[model samples]
Target: MENKRTEISDLGEFGLIDRISQNFTSVNNETELGIGDDAAVLNSLGSRIIVTSDMLLEGVHFDLSFTPLQHLGYKAVAVNVSDVAAMNAIPKQITVNLGLSNRFSVEAVDEFYKGVKAACDNYKVDLIGGDTTSSMSGLVISVTAIGMVGQDKITKRSGAKEKDVICVTGDLGAAFIGLQILEREKQVFMANPDMQPQLDKYDYIVQRQLKPEARMGVVHELAELDIVPSSMIDISDGLASELLHLSRQSGMGMKIYEDKLPIDKQTYDTAVELGIDPTTAALNGGEDYELLFTVSMDDMEKLKKHADIHFIGYVQSSDKGNIMATKGGNEVEVTAQGWSHFKKP
Candidate 1:
């Protein structure tokens, strides 16, 4: 009873971030970007600099179970860039910090770097700096990205207005389902070493979990069409959570249609196979990494024919309430049920 120790799992991930960053204070005025949005924003002469950081852990956020190191490295960077993209900025530089245990070899570390290099090339962001340290447990990778955009062009989660159309890019729920599949496969392998995984049917959902794209492609399309979203957030959380964030910031409620929600055929089929409600997965599943945004009705013409983006609903008066009219013709209030890492097991 004299000596005591506590487990980190008790604090959860976001709690750890809050505890660590609480003691930190803003110093330099030029340190415009810090720890809030997808990235931080710095003030510059003609442009506002953007910054953001993320850490991927071994057992919690990611499982080395069925995931390859290279994809893990690439995904870590893409997740950060998705934040930068959420700000409507272009990524220019990044710093990577790593915590490795002796279990990983020099060759394994090289493979991780190879993935990082691929992401840098894809996003046109440079690998500027970082630190490599030892960890007693498994691998940990933290990335900080810096980008820039004009002050007038900045998009936060705070600009939606009533009547602004709610839009979502790509589909939803694939990544979460993919995680389920991977976990299932891993258990099967552990149960019988000779049992080969029948993964051919789940390849798409599996890749969605392992190799999520940042949707910079959609950003480019929005730019080419000359439309900026009134408010925006990437869907790292569930669609419901991100929608509520935009609503609170804009002082409005939202009205989205369940019939209009986009779920990939593969995702739907697999969700049913796993005995999960496809609608629930689409609503509350996290880490799809697509952009959830609001655009003025006038900008609608620009994206109407576009393939990936869907006009799911519109911002409404908070007095009217945030509700979804299901495909079955019933209305229900939207709620935030994102992956609560603090979730009781």
Candidate 2:
């Protein structure tokens, strides 16, 4: 059976907006008004609002060759929500803007929105509004997420104090390793059309690359435990990169033990199979979407039993510098060699 493909011109811009708006309804109390208006309105009540915007370009942020439109849409929202989670905030609303080329059909757009809708439901956020425009280039997605946090609960990268314990949620390096497997499979498929890519064994890492979840549960759990991080940043970049961010912003040094770094068995074994050090992957691999944070020694006991969180290190004076004590009993300065969109050739 042949699939139906409706052109975007069949609906026009406003018609397309109307079509997209029909599928989404605001579920957030803060969202006083949503789609079909000049601008969405929000009622923040007394909480401080945190806004974050992220843009995903076609070839730069993702490759559509093996990436599904649905997963891409879900990822677009997840990355932005991860930013909100890093601030210790509750995501309330999101506005997704898209630039679609004529090559994209209405059905294709629908598939993408299905993923977006799934994410909105999972995160308990409302899809308020967004813009759809024609594009000469491929698909472009820009997501802006709005979250709420009480003044006392808000966390920032610069709030870490000396002696505070460094912690990370979930694991690291899986996403980076996943990307490698994807690219490798893509190459194999390209070289031999008949070759089926062996991806069943790499399911976890592949999903980490394709559909990452924002660590909102951790944020909620922290609130329930009455523990607030002194400093926090989502591990969108590598762990080392985010650590450097905390060090530079907090005006403190970090000392993390290599053995303390968390790594999944699959991520570690796969890294070894690929001849890449799992520790290096955890250190410099980007897009983990995990939370890297710090808590004072006083609050550390509260999280001591948390299964997902790992105590990796502690904050120190700037003179001591950012160092990672190796399992071999050696110290080395941490460096940021993670993802860079604009790197000099």
- Most TM-score-accurate candidate: 2
Please name the candidate that would achieve the greatest lDDT relative to the true structure.
Answer: 2
TM-scores of all predicted structures: 0.87, 0.98
Tens-digit lDDT track for model 2 on 46-156? 999999999999998999998899999999999999999999999999999999998899989998998899999999889998999889999999999999999999999
TM-score computed on alpha carbons, candidate 1 = 0.87
Cα displacement (Å) at residue 343, model 2: 1.8
Kindly report which residue stretches of model 1 are placed more than 4 angstroms away from their true locations once superposed.
1-45
- For each candidate in turn, give its C-alpha RMSD to the true structure in angstroms: 9.1, 1.1
Residue pairs in collision within model 2: none
The pairs that clash in candidate 1 are: 32-41, 33-41, 39-51, 39-52, 40-51, 42-49
The Cα RMSD in angstroms, rounded to one decimal, for candidate 1 relative to the true structure is: 9.1
By summed lDDT, which 10 consecutive residues of candidate 1 come out lowest? Answer: 1-10
